[model samples]
Target: MNINKLIRIFFLLIISSIEIGQSLVPVERHGHSAVLVDKKLYFFGGESVFGKLKNSIHLDQILYIDLSKPFNTANPPFEEVINAPMPFGSSYATAFLSPQKKNIIYLFGGIMWDVNANVDKFKSILYSYNVETNEWIPPATTGIAPEKRREINGVINNETGKFYAFSGLDTNAQNVVTTFNDMNILDINSLTWSKGSITNAPLPRVDYTATLLSNGIIVFIGGRETNNLVSVDINQLPLYDTKVDRWSTMTARGVTLENRNSHSAILTSDEKIIVFGGNKDDIATPVLNPLAVLNTKVVPYEWSVPTPAPPLPLTTNLHSATLVENYMFINFGQVHPKNDSLLQKPFFYILDVRNFTWVEKFEPEQLSQSPNGTTTVNTSSTNSPGLGVTTPDNGKQIGIIIGAVGISVGVIAVAGLLGYKYYKKQKYTRAIPTAGSPTI
Candidate 1:
């Protein structure tokens, strides 16, 4: 083999931007949110950094990707922009779209950092976006927003469009500790938010999973407290029914489906809830494993041991996931890399939940893809007043600085060379509307 040819081959070798099984890039931040609307999936702000604590690097821009369209690295579907930016930059904000044709998505208060790195208090701002006009409007009714929530679960009762939120962990007095148990619900049609009846509610947890059952029941899964302890036995998760406004005291016994947080609850089309890849043995350094979820409808006290289910391609936490028609499209998230200081690589995988198969192979050349690289910068900016940007002192690119720079350069260069010719044709040439005349 010629050495020169080898060098050229290396340069041409397109290490894929597509992540098949393991993450191609590390998704550093957690608590970011995603939704599917207009056959397109949209994602909003969340914190991303190389620290145990959440940071103030809030992203104000929205990311929308088409689900119906096939995505390829060689030819990717371009992301479309919607109406206007939200009022402020935020992460872990609670949002759910009204299920009507309007497909209006509502966002309630979570938390945002002012231009300063100091994480701002939970916001009371409530706004909704319309899929049709790409417009935002405040609902007619106004009242107190949920006390600034952080990890509270976001579940829309499929029965009603109302969103059900539960406990989440947040920083208390100092950045040193964890925050806990608060529950709230919002009526989408009226745009009114009110506290849910709290009785035997589970202790405050940050990363719990909630599954709205078909039998008009809301099942709350494993979520731990601020102290990182399970208030209930690891073997059982506290259950609640929003419809009856009562608790299912039956500790789902026997099965080791430990009520764990940061796990995924994907309700399958066949009406079975599939819980996958969450830390169980420990929470501090979560050990992610796949567990099967049984119907266990209404029989609140019975706990069935989860048959060791098929394994996911990778261990992921803080990654974004959504259920498409036949598959679950999980986006990039962080893995505890051996080297903590350095960023983890981000990657995505498509799970065929129906067949219980995690795709290890795909038409790599044809799969939809993007380069989602992560870097941290202090986004503490005072450009505006109270609503300021966090300008990172250490300069960084959160994702891509995508804009018109490339197009502008190309257009300007071409225009300069063709300027004289165009001018000459206009000034010296006679105007004629001939049948075959060139348009330009």
Candidate 2:
């Protein structure tokens, strides 16, 4: 080959390497919902192109995938728990199991109308599903019934059995849905409601955040009104206190977090709300914010340092980020320069919160196998298709029940390899770099 051609080929090779290293993978569909039950993660209904909500998990009317089994894996075509239907067969409702009340998972108001402004018509109703009884109880009308709301954010303070519902859009007389500032606290035990006209509330916004800190205070942030579904910054907005049901203008310590919506927040083992990316307002889509992390009490909100970790590999995407135990799992989301309307199908990435690092891409099969024993039959079977049907689990499916924990072992392994490579590369590169001697 000609000398010039050889040099050109070498440069091309380097470029190809860079591109390959940066390639993003295709995950699952958009518009899906997820909840963490008994350490395992269960994803439910999502909107499809046909515009019909899908219950792909259920064989008949029930959701098909419980995903709490030990043998579950992402290898492909794995068995999902085809048992049990969601309380009302609803989607887009903020869903989560109460940490203190294992028997129930609380799903509060949600709808699919406005991406930013409130669409006047939305269901104010919220319900809870009892995993043990397989029953759905609507919020009591006189007791804890939420003020009629849709698309509002809900957070449960398990310690106090209080579910705090805040900042959503309401319909005007002409039937126009606009942003609202109403804050209603619902008691899970008493099924009672407390409507507090909170003072100095964050401006009327939707898609904003209200997270329950380990200290038992509520941190409110990122949403939109006439604007878009993005908070200017987690730092810009003040965090709220649920204990007293009050608002404060203070911030957290350390690195200020990026404003995000459609993103998930998890309470880390060490007590921090590790935030991942969501859609950015400047753009019409979701993107990963590598610089997202929050730690501290809420009253006088302070900023904390974000882990100098890898960015969400792509932009203009939103995924269901679920925290199982200490591990943070981000499920199938989209990427866009392509626009939010076009997101990749669902897949997942995990972060080992204890170690403060992001995990490499792996399917469900890569996780640890769950412990095997007699299936707990205390669970009543209803529309749930396939429960208590334990054949010989492949060990992979059962691992999911063990939760994001299996990934912890993998994190250790990956860390060892990375450390070894870094040490060797630094030593070898250092030994080779003597510019004065190499000049010959």
Candidate 3:
């Protein structure tokens, strides 16, 4: 190959590799957690089922992907941390990094299938994993820990190393599933649990995601009440003021988000809550990518439909997403197609929050012909604190970067090749004693 061709081929290979690497992940399942540390993503226990009547399968292996590495699906930079297996296989538990210690991930409360009893068992044990050592530490605690539960959500106060465990579902003796409205804080330093005073808390709920704001506010949205698995109204958003140890509701301004459960909601570094991928009253709503952004900085918080949405290759519920810099990594959700088959894959997707654009890992052959991209929703008031205004029009910046890089590489390659050829030609002419040239 010519020098220019070789250079062009190198850039293409890099782009191709990055595309493939983003898709390399663990087996597809819901109830799993993808915890981000530095540029690495650590994936842990989740459950899947092969047949309708078959027993639910719980995942035990620990897999992680280093985002810094080049994309290689077959030889991906995924490392399976072996040695200590979880005390039991569990799912829908709360996973977060300990604010007090470095390299420690804490997992609390999840459900496990009891094969012998043919029932689901809830776990309340607190397990900590040392990310640096790849070891599991089951920490014993004092005070009253919350009841055994699953599908619960929690957030850590990085400043105090205190983790707040929120409401979740539990099974009663009669095989009845129950939920809690209880709130408790686990102090990583003391290894103790203490109940917190929650005033005007919402009803017993599960499958909701919570985001902690810099101002010590915890916003909980889109979960099912124990009585009904149906969607909840968006008007009443629950905001917990950690400073006062109380919970209150806020009337959402502007557009209301679609009522959803089993969705992924994350607080971006820019202080906006980005919610994506969930079931709207049991129907998959994948078309809602960029799903919604709530500007929490403003009082009487308002919700806006995101611009430059992603392509919905499939409808998903029960997925998890975490934010890292300008990129949000989402993975492992239940896909419900029109054929009525429930599917889960280990693939994932990425959203560039800076521009509200999407990065897809997998594109099925039978994608819906839905219109792509989001229309401009009502804009937040300029008075809203720290609102970084961006538009769908600016989304082209990402595409431009990729195109520019590829073009730049080609131009440099061509220029270098031409320079090399010209030098060679001049040297050759000189060596041939052209005109008054002297022979050595």
Candidate-wise lDDT, in order: 0.53, 0.52, 0.67
Q: List TM-scores for all candidates, in order.
A: 0.65, 0.63, 0.71
Quality of model 2 by C-alpha lDDT: 0.52
Per-residue lDDT of candidate 1, residues 336-372 (tens digit): 4434543344345666655666664322122222343
lDDT by residue (96-200, candidate 2, tens digit) is 566466667666765433322323243556667676676767656455355454545577665667777776764556877666567877766776777855698
State the lDDT of candidate 3 residue by residue for 1-440, as single tens digits: 67567656656665654443233344556787667654467787677664222344776657777654334333345667667555456678878876556478888888655534456653446888888877766688999877788887788877767788778887766888877778888888899999877678888788887777878888888877878876667557888887889888999898866787887777766678888867767655543543788887788888888666546435466777766545566766787553324363454666677788876431111212335553222111101112222233334656876887777677667666766886788789767866676767
Q: How would you order the candidates by lDDT, starting with the best? A: 3, 1, 2
Error of 1 at 184 (Å): 1.7
Model 1 stretches astray by more than 4 angstroms: 1-28, 50-56, 72-85, 115-122, 132-144, 172-182, 227-234, 253-255, 280-284, 297-312, 338-344, 360-440
Clashes of 1: 24
Q: TM-score for candidate 2, please give it.
A: 0.63
Candidate 3 residue pairs in backbone clash: 21-71, 28-345
User: Cα lDDT for residue 128, model 2?
Assistant: 70
